[model samples]
Target: MPVIVLEARDFSSPIFLVRTLEVISGCITFSLVASLEPPKDPSDLHPTFRIFCMFIWCFFFTLTLLIHILSIIQFHSLIPISWKNLTVTTAVLGALMGLSASVVFPWMVIDHQGSLQRPVAAAVASCITFLAYSSETCILRTQAQEQRGYMGSNPGLLKILQLWGGCNMIPLVLGVVQSQWSALGTPSGVLSWQLWVSAVLYSVCVLMSLVTLVVILGDFAGRCFLPFDRFLAGFSLIGVFLYMFATVICFTKILQLKEPGNRASAQMTELIIMETVVASITLLAYTVDLAFSIKLLCDRSHA
Candidate 1:
C-alpha cells in the first residue's frame, strides 16, 4: 500500500501573476500611445486629447503595477490587515481601469477614418488584461458586502468636511462650465464628443461628492470611520481633487489663448505635464484610501 498527498496551490500566486500581465499590457499601451504621431490637421484628433488619454492610461497602469508588485512581494502585510483582501481589491481596480483604457484609448484616437489599427490593437490588449485581472479578483474575493451606516454626532468633523467640499466644488463647477462653454463655442479644434462626456461625468462627480458630504453631516449613532464610510469619503475627496485639476487645466488653457481663434500651442507641454502630476497624485490617494477602507472592513468582519 502507498499513500499520496496533494499540496494546494497558494491562491495569491495567481492574483500576482495576473496583475503582472496587466502591468505588462499597461506598459505596452503607454508605449503605443506615447509613440503615436500627432495629427497634422487641426480638424483631426487634437494632440492635447491624445496627451490626456495617454496620461490617464499611464497613471492608472503605473499605480496598478506598483501596488500589485508590492502585493506580490508581500509588502502589503506591513499594514495591519489581510493581504489577500488587498490583493483582491487591487485586482478589481486594475480590471476597471483596464476597461476604461480599452474604450478611451480607441475613442481618443479615432478621427476621419484614419488608421484604426493602433487603437484596435491597444483595445484588444487591454481587454485581455481586463479579463485576467477580473478573473483573479473573483477568485480571491470573499463574501463581504461593503456597506456602512452614517456617522455619529460629530458636528465639527461634518463642518470641516463640508467646508473642504465646498471649496473643491466651487472651483470645479466653475471649471467644468468654463471648459464646456469654451469647447461648445469653439468646437473646431477640440474633441467635441469627449468634451461633452467629460462635462457630464464631472457634473455627476460633483453631485456625488456633495451628497456624500451631506451623508456625513447627518447625525446617527455609529462609528464613522467604518470601512464603507472611508470608501465614500475617499471617493469624494478623489473627485474633488480631479475636479480641481480639471479647473486648473481649463483656466490655464483659457489664459494661454490670445484671441478667439488663436490656439494655445506652447502650453500643451506644460498642461500635459500638469495632468500627469495631478493624475498620479489622485490615483495614489484613491488607491491608499480604498485599501485602508477594505482593510478596516476585513478587520471589523473578523472582530
Candidate 2:
C-alpha cells in the first residue's frame, strides 16, 4: 500500500492562495444566490441562467476543493492522469465558465430583476471568482512551460482554446435553435437544415477537442499507432474549413430573421450573434493550431 504524506509547503504556494480564493468566492456567490427569495414572477426571469450560474459555482467549488485536498495529501501521484494537465485544464475551464456565469447571471437574472442586494452581491462575488480562476490559469500555464508539460506547449494551449470555443458554441447554437424552432420550421413543420448543420458541426468539434484533451491527459498519445502531430494538423486544417462554413451559414441565417421586437427575441438574437463570433474565433484558433502542428511535424521529419 502507498503511504500518505502531507505536503505542508503547498499550502503557502501562490497556486494554493489563488485556489483558496476561488473556493471562498465561489462559495459566497452561490450562497448569496441561493439565499435570495424566488423571483416574484418566475416567467420574468430566465431560470436557466440562474441554474447555470449556480451549477458553475458549486461544481468549481467542489472540484477545486477536492483538488486542493488531493494536493495536500499528495494523493495526485496515485491517480493515473497527469497532474499538470489536470490542474491546467481545470483552471482554464473554471476561468471560461466563471466568465460566462459572470456575464450571464448579471445580464439575464440580476438585470431582469431589480438591483436586489443579494443578486448584485452574488454577481460581484462571481466576477471576483472569475478573476481568481483566470489568475490561476495564467500561473499554471507559466509553470507548465518550466515543467515541460505537454499541455503547456503551443499546440496544447490551442487545444484548450478550441475546447472552450466549442463549448460556448454548443450552448449558444442549441439555445438559438430551441428558441426559434417554430420560426425556423417549414410549412411542414420540418426544422431548417442549416440549424441542424450548425449544431452538428459544433457538437462534432467539441467531441474531437474533448477526445484530444483526454488522450493527452492519459498520456496515451505515444501509445497510439497514428502519428499524433500529423493527426492534429489534419484535424485542425479540416476544423478551420468547417468552422468557416458554419460561421457563414450561422451568420447569414441569423441575419435573415426579423428584427427583435421583444426582450425574448432580442436575447435569442444576441445569443445567435455571440455564437457566430465564437465560431469565427474558433476558426482562427484552428488555423493557428494547424500552422503550429505543421511546423512541429516538419521539424520532427528533419530530425
Candidate 3:
C-alpha cells in the first residue's frame, strides 16, 4: 500500500497563492464568456476567438488543479516528469497564453460588443488571470535561478520568450491570411507571396522553438549528439533574419492596403497590426538570444 502525506509547504508557499488566484480568475473568465450567447452577426468577430479564450482559461485551470492534487498527495516522485521543469514551463506558457487571451478577448469581442456586462466582466477576469500567471512565472523564474535547470539560465529564459512569441505570431498570421483570402477572392500576386512567406517563417520558427523546449524539459540537451549550443546560435541567427524579412513584408503590405484607393476593413487592419507587432517583438527576442548564445559558447570553450 502506498502512503500519502499532505505537503504543508505547498499550501503555504507564494506560488500556491498565485496559483489560487489563477484558478479563481480562470474559472471566472471562462464562466462569464461561456454564459453568453454566440454572436449571430456574420460581420462580428468570429466565434473561434471566443472559443480560444475559453480553452486557455479552462485548460490552465485544469492543469493548476492537477498540480495542486499531486502536491497535496505528495506524489511528485511518482510522476516521471521533472517537477520543476513542468511547473516552470506551465507558468511560462500559461502567462503567455493568458496575456494573449486578455488582449484578444477584450479587443476582438468586448470592444465590439459595446460594453456588455458579461463580456466586460470576462475581459476583466482574463486580464486578472494574465497577471496571476505572470506573477507565478516571475516567482518560478527567480526560484529556478538557484537550481541547476537549463531554463534558469539567461539563454534558456530567452528561449521561452522566443517560443511564446513564435506561438503568438502563428495565430495572428493565420488570422490575417484568412481575412485576406476572404477579401481577395483567391490567393494571388504579391499578397499571396507575402502571406506564404509569413506563414512559412512563423511555422519554421515555432517548430524549432517547440523542439528546443521539449529537449530542455526532457533534460535531453546533454544526451543529444548534436552541438546544442551551436545549433541554438545558428537557429537564433536564422530566426532574426526570417523575422526581419517577414516584418518588413507585413508592414509594406499594410501600407499598400492603406493607400488612397485601397483600404482593408477595421478588423483586417487590426489583425495585420497585431501580427506585425508580434513579429517585431519576436525579432528582438531572437536577436537577444543570438547574443546570449554566442556568449555562452565562448565561455564554455574557455572553460
User: How high is each candidate's TM-score?
Assistant: 0.47, 0.87, 0.90
Worst 10 residues of 3 by lDDT: 144-153
Rank the candidate models, highest TM-score first: 3, 2, 1
lDDT of 1 by residue, 42-127 (tens): 64334545555566467657777767655545564455433443444345555555655565456546552266777667667767
Q: Write candidate 2's Cα lDDT for 132-226 as tens digits.
A: 99999888777737463777777877888888888777557656765664344431222367777887888888888988888888988898678
Candidate 2 lDDT:
0.80
Candidate 3 residue lDDT tens string, 91-204: 888888898998888777775564499898888898899899889888877763555366656776778888888877766766776677667667569888888888898889
Regions of model 2 farther than 4 Å from truth? 1-9, 36-45, 144-148, 181-191, 258-264
Q: By lDDT, rank the candidates, best first.
A: 3, 2, 1
Task: After superposing candidate 3 on the true structure, give the runs of residues whose Cα lies further than 4 Å from its correct spot.
Answer: 112-115
- Residue 154: error of model 3 in Å? 2.4
Model 2 RMSD vs true structure = 3.1
